[model samples]
Target: MPVPTTRDKNPASILIEADKCSGCGLCVNVCKDFGLEIVNNKVHQSDKALFGCIACGHCMMVCPTDVIAIEGRTLSPVLMFELPEKSQAADYESLLAMFKRRRSIREFKNKAVEKEKIEKILEAAQTAPMGIPPSDVHVLVLENKKQVRLFAEDFSNYLKGLRWMSSRWFLALIRPFLKKENNEMMHDFVKPLFDVYVDDMDKGNNWINYDAPLAMYFYGSPYADPADPIIAATYAMLAGESLGLGTCMLGAVHPFIQNGKKASAFRERWGIKYPSREGLVVIFGYPAVHYQKGVKRTFAHIHRVS
Candidate 1:
């Protein structure tokens, strides 16, 4: 009787061609799960793997002879492609210039963003790295100003029900239970933010989404790493910048819509899959104003162990 491989039990599959394998040990060395080993002077799947094949494609991507192939679990060997020439890529100076050019644009022209540009931004963001093999990031796209305003209105109404969360009595009651930093943040930043959003909305001003022509909300599932959606949103922002679009990341919406029955219903209405640990809303449109200069930015502290 033959032993059942990981693929036999799961959807992930791997293929290795003995003739093409150079046995250079690159695949074996890079297989962190110990799924590959040298057997009979050739690279072969090892039975003593830690957790079986994860379909991460490390072996297939590293193999110079193209002897390995991985498929299933939303991945395939056909997805592999040759990287661009190194000389065509951006150098440090050019990359830094692009980074410095990015600004959080709030004032937008009264115009619509073309659907093709939005699609291109999404295409570029799709290349962002994920914490796992299959990405769990979800995006809610409000393609027009009306849709964005409608969402903002719905969110504002939802916030009314949870107003007590920011009340002084509520803060006093929860301060003892919360961590020191959390309690301080609740009193100092979160409470004021809630007030500003709700109050501004009541006065007929849409402070939530800023009436941008295109708004994208990136979120993650319960099992996802918190940084996954954030990184994806950042990528989308940069892609939008490259296409001559103004972009601003809205960080306030995610936390307010994360808990309670009302929040759940709001998420269901928008088709958000999970209460993500971290999320971001990026708004895109043509710029209405331009700045002549940008200020330098730096971290508050940096330390080197050496």
Candidate 2:
């Protein structure tokens, strides 16, 4: 039977093989949407579904007998993979060590990132969890240093065109609407960032993307969750680190290129899909320098209810 969702016009098809059904009830227990139930001691679609099936695949994934299959809305049973052995997984200490080794590397070597490494990074990023089952994230890959530099130059010029936004009069006009903290941020941080990006670029300095060998901009469609692209970009960064490539996340480019006619034109030229709520740019390259020690970092605070 097919169950429709709010996002998909056509319902997703769920097939249940009666002979292979073990009736363990794991699938029924894991289905958050109440889309599945036991019918005469066998798994079946529940008629009392809240919003029909979202096709999140919990039912299929949890089934011990592989009796259930889902198809539609970019999901397919064919895409299923065998879970890796527990022994193959990384320990907490190893993960923490890798995290400590990762730094925001702005300085890069003259060497270019291998194509295989870039592909592997993208592959790992695709495995990141998304807000929805089928990801709406899009990645724009600038393969080499030349391409990255060209884009940064173009972006700097674009920012220069809108320099009036950083003016004192403009900040004053928007202060009342923006509130105190944001107003101060505009004057203190954002205005200075704009100045440095534009001014430094004029003197052949690239503060935008840092002239890395490779850069990836991850963005989302109108239907995508704001965090989807960011999570994917983070995954890409971690993958780059694992591959021995230096990486840095550039957040300044996204918000600046999200509005106005000129921004739209720039997006069109670059094949960027939508003016996403959130996006991220990560640059990767061989390291030009190495650090002997890592600094410890802490959160602002951690609250415990208990």
Candidate 3:
């Protein structure tokens, strides 16, 4: 049976042009599912496929000739395009420079990101790899500062209803079920964060999203892998950096808006279609401040297997 997603239930249809096939085996080599094989020196659909055609489009993309057409599961041969030349891609130094110069920017100039730039950011994000084809990631875009601030205000109001979650009684009640680090974080970081988000926004301090000119909340359907939206959001962030826009990832809003009637209502109000296990909100804008130097950072640990 085909893997089910929120969008489609059936597997893709794989059509092969036997007359055009050169039997080069490029498509066969790339298709790990063993969906296609050479028979009598012509490509043919094989019964050995594990999940049928996932509509990954890898076979069609790799074919030397226009021999394969993948249809269904939101994919088609028409969707294929010419790949950009390798020279057009950024070199290691340029990529590292962009990464190093990037930082979490909350202070933004009172300027809106251009519509073209916003579209480009999304286009780049669509190229991100996913756990499955026909990626389940969805994005909610707040196109300007007014919408962003309004969303923050509404979210702050919603947080008011969830203030009980940060209470001492609730913490004590839930502490035993949580791991030590999680328990400490719930008491320390999360509790204070809830208060700060609700309280500060009430006083006209827009820390919820820092009043950025543009914001995109990337999330997935219940059927999606938890990392799908996160990976897409990261791609969007990198795209923002490439476009000279400042960006910041706001993690606090996601967990709060995930599990209850109040949360469901809040989601419905904002057009969020489903409650996913993980999601992220990224704000983008022209930065008000400029950095003089890039800071070096490191991972917690990096140990290769012996």
Candidate 4:
């Protein structure tokens, strides 16, 4: 027979016999070169991996039955198992430009976010690098506006109950200033966007949470030595941004949920018990107002060591 043209070396040809394949679809997912596809519930060749497969063998390894085989002609292609195309990624200057352009969004649209889009964002949260293995971080998805209102009332009362634990004079002294002061601190810790949101709610209307059609609460065990919900929440927030959704972190709400009565009711209704670890709440929705652009930044100096 003539020299097999398949002998050209990158990923030359993939010989897959369907009869031997269990139709696991693992190969379809593992092939990074866009070299495989599943049709009629079976896997088949989609593209020649000659320039693509990189000969990493991910497909062959994950294959349970050892049916798939990859043939190569030349040097193997580089595998991207650790990170995504960092070699081709932008330089430090370019990244600083992107960070400078980042902005905090306020004012969400009246539109409802699609369930599938929410699911995609959550998938990124699931993929976040965990500090330890086998940690259970729970997500509570609230899509109903009515329920959001209920939670807000419950949340407000929860704060009130905590206030009740103090002296009456102290409560009286702080009552008038609580909303004003809480709003300001909220603006500082969470986001400046909450300044407007809290103002609207103070006007006897549950406006902010009302505006957000979606919210997710994340929680983990409190018994752990170091609670890392905030770290995980940070991942979820970035993941949400990557998926083209607007997110505002609500650091203030965790206190109410963990210790307040209104919070207890909300938790009981949802059948969520306190994790012996850490917890967080993340709110997301389409922005009613697009951020015009990122604001100016404060300067920081970096020290480099040779």
Candidate 5:
């Protein structure tokens, strides 16, 4: 059986150069799917594979000899590159410092983000794990403040039609079905958000995306794990910070741009491919405001259970 993903339905084809095989069993040992084995002093495809070759390419990546190659399912030898030296990677302390320095910046300078920075942000985001091979995450890049504002305005207009969802009667109707926290969130948070995002936009204030210089919408297909786009968005946000660009994740857009014919039409206008269960939009630019101090944050709970 092959692992199903949005990109491909079939398992990757493994090509073994039996004549070049050293019978070292290196590929066999590393094949977590049990897709390879050595028999009669030659490496061969195994019959007892757990899920055939899902094409993680671990066997090819670890092989000392270039005897195994994976083809199809978005796997290619050309995609391989030399790993960066461990010493060149960010240390824990430096990474922690970067994390601490980052603040959710909404107000931004009018200057545009450089194209090179945008490209590098995408490059780093591509390295994020997607819970599956050949990540299904797709990104829509709005490269300038004008484009971002346009999208924000369009989204605000869209939200105008959805205002009824935040009405008192609607909240009262749904309160009994939702958890206490969700009910409170819908009432105290989301309702006011609806007012500000739409009404402010009507008054020529772009509260939706804050008119940032750059924006990226990371989303996934139906077959994608819901966390895929969220993880990619986080990576992009961190990449923006590393590139000296302020960043903020806009949560209101994705949920609204899903379901119903109107939402589908809006997505089509913006070139979005599919309705993802989870998605995020991150706006980037030079920050208008700077913080002198870092805020300490903690998780609600941390547990270690035996």
Candidate 6:
């Protein structure tokens, strides 16, 4: 279903042949502004938001089998955005308005998101594309904060004591002039969730992951290459954004889990097999804040040698 803008008017009467409809209700689900609804396993014209339909045609794209007809027939037809016969300043102005509207949100309202909504976001994540063809990747969705905390704590313990190598051995063997890295690394040593984003993680005050509501972990298989898990995790994050959810990538924990003695323990607790070193973790939550405006960015220079 395409959203009909001012330049593109909605056909007087668009018809959907119920007989061809699979009752998937993708049109209703995808077009939230249109207020389309699924009733009795069929799509019912929603009187609530019919006027707001932008006719973006997303509904037509999501339909699995041919079912919806825009104008009068059941066959998929070519829908085009009508351009003015003559150029006008208003057209470009409107286009810029739409382009400037999207912004990445960091803050979120205190309102708790429903579990069903979170599940929907996960469903979208599952649909994300993979880098390799049918590669081995495991996606773990941390639905609860406690689970995420446990994973973080377990990872933190794994990281403990390992810093002695970089702090003591490397410094002693290599150039003595190099600044003491152990102290800095230990200071930076975060107890997984406790240290990823939060500034304070002491017993009394804890702000790890900035009190995020959920986390998602991506684990690669032993048989797959190291980059496989990372690519999958990246896909999941993009999918999260499409669902209007906030995400943050947590990288430190994965390294600790792979090289430390606690690695086996963490793997057993999560019931996940230790893959290659490429395991990745990411946090997802309803943002505690929002950004109404986009920050300015520096332009990058590119050259094509060929």
Highest lDDT: give the candidate number.
3
Count residue pairs with overlapping backbones in model 5: 0
TM-score of each: 0.93, 0.95, 0.98, 0.55, 0.95, 0.52
Where model 4 places Cα greater than 4 Å from the true spot, the runs are 1-101, 165-168, 171-203, 207-210, 224-227, 260-263, 275-278, 296-306
Please provide, for model 4 over 181-233, each residue's C-alpha lDDT reduced to its tens digit, 9 standing for 90 to 100.
77455435434334333544556566445546677777765432234456666
- Mark the regions of model 3 whose C-alpha exceeds 4 Å error after superposition: none
Across residues 157-276, which tens digit of lDDT does each residue of candidate 1 receive? 888888898999999999889999999999998898788789999998888999999999999887777898999999999999989999999999999889888899999999887898
Q: Model 6: per-residue lDDT, tens digit, 149-183?
A: 66555544544445444444554565455466744
Model 2 C-alpha RMSD vs. true structure (Å) is 2.1
Sort by lDDT, best first: what order?
A: 3, 5, 2, 1, 4, 6
Q: TM-score: which candidate is best?
A: 3
Q: Is candidate 1 or candidate 2 better by lDDT?
A: 2
TM-score of 2: 0.95
For residues 1-306, what per-residue lDDT tens digits would candidate 5 score against the true structure?
887887898989999999998899989998889888899989999899998788888889888889999987898999998999999999999999999999999999989898899999999999998676878999999999889989988888888888999999999999889999999999998999999998888899988888999999999999898999999999999999999999999888899888999999999999999999999999999999999998688999999899
**Residue 85 lDDT (model 1):** 100
Taking all chains together, the TM-score of candidate 6 against the true structure is 0.52
Better of 2 and 3 by TM-score: 3
> In what order do the candidates fall by TM-score, top score first?
3, 5, 2, 1, 4, 6
Worst 10-residue lDDT window for candidate 4 reads 1-10
Question: Backbone collision count in every prediction?
Answer: 0, 0, 0, 14, 0, 17
